[model samples]
Target: MSARARERPGQHDVAHPAWTLVMSVAASSLSFIDGSILNVALPAIRADTGAGAAEVQWVVNAYTLPLAALILLGGALGDHQGRRRWLVIGTVLFGIASLVCALAGSLQTLLAGRALQGVGAALLLPNSLALLNGAYSGEARGQAVGTWAAAGAISAAIAPLAGGWLVQQFGWPSIFYVNIPFVGVAIVIALTRVEEVSDPGSARLDLGGAALATLGLGAATYGLTLWSQTFALSTLAGGAIAAGLALLVAFGLYERRLGDKAMVPLSLFGNRCFTSLNLMTFLLYGAFGGAMLLIPFTLIEAGGYSPVEAGLALLPLSILIGGASRMMGKLAEKIGPRWPLTIGPIIVGIGLALASRLAESQSYWTHAFPAILVMSTGMALAVAPLTSTVLASVSRHQTGMASGLNSALSRLGGLIIVALLGAVLVAQGDALLRPFAMALRMMGVVAALGGVAAFFGLSGNWRHADSGTETV
Candidate 1:
């Protein structure tokens, strides 16, 4: 790629800015749509495959664990290698994995495919965002990120509705098959339109840090998922958790020792704003992820709703976020991210708390719609700004790593919550309601804490200056 393309593709003609956005959105939609669709399809999958609650949770976590673990390395590799190259490669891998999933005849085969999908997602997501970062700057960057978020939200909105119908009409495998054509389109656009960009002086690959991170997160996730299933701190679960924690601590120490050479540069945490924003990301996204999984399951299993109805219940969230996030992103560019970041998660907390009142007898318009509407409004306010702020927290060269870390944290939050949902998952019919409500309320408090983090951690006028570092 030309130097101009690497530094500022928006200013040159190597690729149209609009096409770059399209390619990024299309590539990201693979992950976003897969997640939303799978939530709707989970019940069908469990029934068809005779999966217990534990195995069901594994179906989701199998994808999330690896995505969370290796995403930082993916970002680092993109910086050291080439962003566009990895983007295409990831797309192809994801497509193949989707095919494998579509053809899977057993739980183990399905899990292997899901794990591959996670690996592909890990490779693609950060680079997609980094491509935009390399192409745009300042207000335009915020708008582009907003557009990207909005497009992904729109895709997510459509996925469940479409996936529910497919699952209901054809089978769960149809959901996996849907990804193939989308992946093909994304690959073509990425290869033809997106310019390759990388930092020439980027550090060599941190294989040790990557290994430690993968093992630590995988072990922790395994322990937690097992604990949820067994509902006991058995020796196996306890040992795995203990070992995982120790490995994570060692991973942190190793990264710190490696300095800038680590897959995760510990120095990024030195920026108070960056640190606080990511903490908020973890808390808020955890709540959102848990809610996403539970709400549909509750509707299907407890409330006697069909998959289609359950999917429809979340339509408000997708529409509101898709419609409003771009405007919110621009608003944050002007006023700074502090207030949006603070207020959004608090509103989400309120919405989740309200949702905990859900009952089987309650009407969707009266109970579910109201809660979803409120949560949607809050996420619309927060999502775009949270992403833009994280990117702004670091220099241009670190955009890939920064995006990866934020994305990883979001997935990690979801992975942990899903792992902890074993008790809820095992409950049947009306019994599911109580535990589900408790989880929602707990998640609400977590979301509220995220709001508090932003309020205290970021200055009111904080923004990224021309130097590519935050200022107030």
Candidate 2:
């Protein structure tokens, strides 16, 4: 280990933990707000720019693909360099990308900007958490994380509503412009108040692995998006998909060779519980990503809801998940994660099924509200336990890597589903309802399968699992 790598976590303290927490939350919110807000603004973006379904899908996936593929590398970069330095750099880059997006007049320009935003978010998200972990210890660390989670939940709840209002009032470009001030403030605070911290010993940059993963995911997403647009797999699409799979396989082999030094230590997957939990994460989150995008679009286009009203429709999900996740987490500690994990996704499936039955003429209170309430309750039950169990499943030293991997999988799930929704994305007004319903029903099945995976794949007594080693 180098001399700098030998410096203990405690030696690098922030001037105040609160400032560190504030900077972390503010920086992280850029991605969260951007994501939630863009769903509401997509309709306006398409209307203004005359973008087709494929182009709109590119807008969303362009950001998500890079974020999902490069997130692990981003975390490693922070460890190699300084978290604070990279956090500020990420903020500046995201702000500039937002400007480019806001000023974009063409589909091509907008996509280029969105892709840059994803790169910036990849750097910002993991480093914010790493910075928080480095700045505090023990009880204070837990408190800070809880505060950060709560703040994130609040910001997520507000983003759609706020973004919807902005979109309705000023246009879709205004939504991107809103990010400028927040990023500006976060950049200033990160530079002035946050302390620099890094672990050179653990910071191994697997550039080849990162490059392969990015190319693989990008190619696969492009293939899927093309298939969705054409409803047929052309030779080009098939070739892209095949090449993506091959590259992904190569990525796995390469990581396996790198062992502990790999960006994603493949040994983590040797734990059956960890592997199973991640598979469940992908299925559940993929369903969620599809629902979130389709719900607002359907409401605005088919159900005659304005942008702001469509945003309000999702408030139940945000509020319930935010308010109830801690209670669910505590419950999991007592009874174990098995039951919550099993039942939660099942409930979400039921909710999606209910949502599929919604008609344009149905009242929001009677149809839409009930479905969202059920889905929110299910997510509230699952989200906390799933996260805590993922952490507890690994040894203390691997927790950061494990969490980053899990986060990346979740985003990857969303990215895949969005890429496959060209049909739904293209439909408008009454024509959208049929494809939208079909998509939700299919996602409901995927969510249910996630529940099944949890039930069969996880140990009954997971709390007592040997955390020092991978549980076979």
Candidate 3:
């Protein structure tokens, strides 16, 4: 091994961890920006392609299902093959996928391209995080995670504004083409700066487990998404959901049989802290996703705001989250994650409760801005510490899978909740005001419960940044 490559955990042996941070952040932005921007492009896509609602939904779902389904396997692949290697490969594939999306002649072609992009994203997200976990240690790792979170927030925040401008000036295809430059930058950085790392213990690929996971998650996600469109249980949706559940059960059993050789080491869930952390992730992210979906529609459809205005309403939130995340990471480093994790979600709940007050004819300053500030502040407090705790809960060697599972939970939470909440939207129909309020309040309840989980479940010492290597 090279001298720098031999550096032990908790040591900043690399000449510039900053470069690693930059590369990872850049790599991650490729997905975050693309995901966020596409929402804005959807109307344009519909206009250009004359696609139906189902096709548009497919355009979005095609990307998300694969991303959520394959992320764990992607992490396992990274751990077994090599993080930097996969990063490079994923970046190239993402660029190619973006190019395909840009040039897509029809809805079906676009959906195919989007699915390919999701595959690239699945490979990129967890490994980017794992690279950070392996590169930084102690307080620095917390800061790096904070920065990574901030970069993601900023990328997501910028997407709407940039996508709108690009779509207006050039075309909807510009959104996909926009990713090309970012992908190029990410690839160059990865090849030049990021170091390769892999777990020898992860040499074996659990192909059966992977296939089962992909099929299960894909079926469940499709069923859930379809369920929203038709509030009643259609035969196809019901069968898909049932089949998905069964396959997932089989996947779990298969993984258990594999023991340590499993793609997702079931033993990781055996750690109380890890389990609690993921449970918290699922609840909080689900709530976050559901509430966010309602907010933009409420503003645009109910409050009579323009689409651009509705998009800008969230600008402050991104800034708050990006700004406050690093400071909160430092706080978690100083005091431990217990208070921040517990208190942060409670505050988020409170903010969401306030958001429930939003209605037609309300001023943006009075109604939306205040809620955004409070919720973003609370979110900023929680995000970094949550990431740190998840990483700290597992051993260094397993960081990729740990990060992958956490990442997958986050995506899955959003996917499932969005689908479920769509039913409420459909049921309410023209009278969306009441449903919107209920969604916000429901999210608030979920957030508060996450705080409860953190308070009772996360051990105090491990919540601290200096917890060392106890492996929970």
lDDT of 2 by residue, 1-472 (tens): 5524423245345467788899899999999889888998888888889999989899899999999998988888888887777788878889999999999979899999999999999999999998898779987998999999998898889988998999999999999998888897888777777767787667869999999999999888988888997689999889989999989999999999999999989998887778888989999999998899889888988888889998998877788999999898888778778989989999999999989977687799999999999999899888988877787777777888888999999999999999999998888888899998999999999998998988886765543244543321
Please list the residue runs of candidate 3 whose C-alpha ends up more than 4 Å from where it truly belongs after superposition: 1-21, 43-57, 131-147, 192-196, 333-335, 357-361, 395-397, 424-432, 459-472
Q: 1-472 in candidate 1: lDDT tens per residue?
A: 4333363355345667788898888889999999999998998898899988888898999999889988877776787778887888888889999999999999999999999999999888878887887778888986897688778888999998998899899999999999888888888877777777886466348889888988998888889988986588989899999999999999999999989888888998887778888999999999999999989988898888888888888887899887887787778778778889999999999999989888787899988999999999888888868876887766776765776788889998999989999998988789999999999999999998998998887874344453265522
Write down the worst ten-residue block by lDDT for model 1: 2-11
lDDT of 1 at 95: 94
Would you estimate the TM-scores of all the predictions?
0.92, 0.95, 0.85
**lDDT leaderboard ranking:** 2, 1, 3
User: Residue 10: error of model 3 in Å?
Assistant: 29
What ranges in model 1 sit over 4 Å off? 1-18, 135-144, 330-335, 395-399, 459-472
Worst 10 contiguous positions by lDDT, candidate 3:
3-12
Better of 1 and 3 by TM-score: 1
Evaluated with TM-score, which candidate comes out highest? Answer: 2
**Number of colliding residue pairs in each model:** 0, 0, 0
| Candidate 2 residue pairs in backbone clash | none
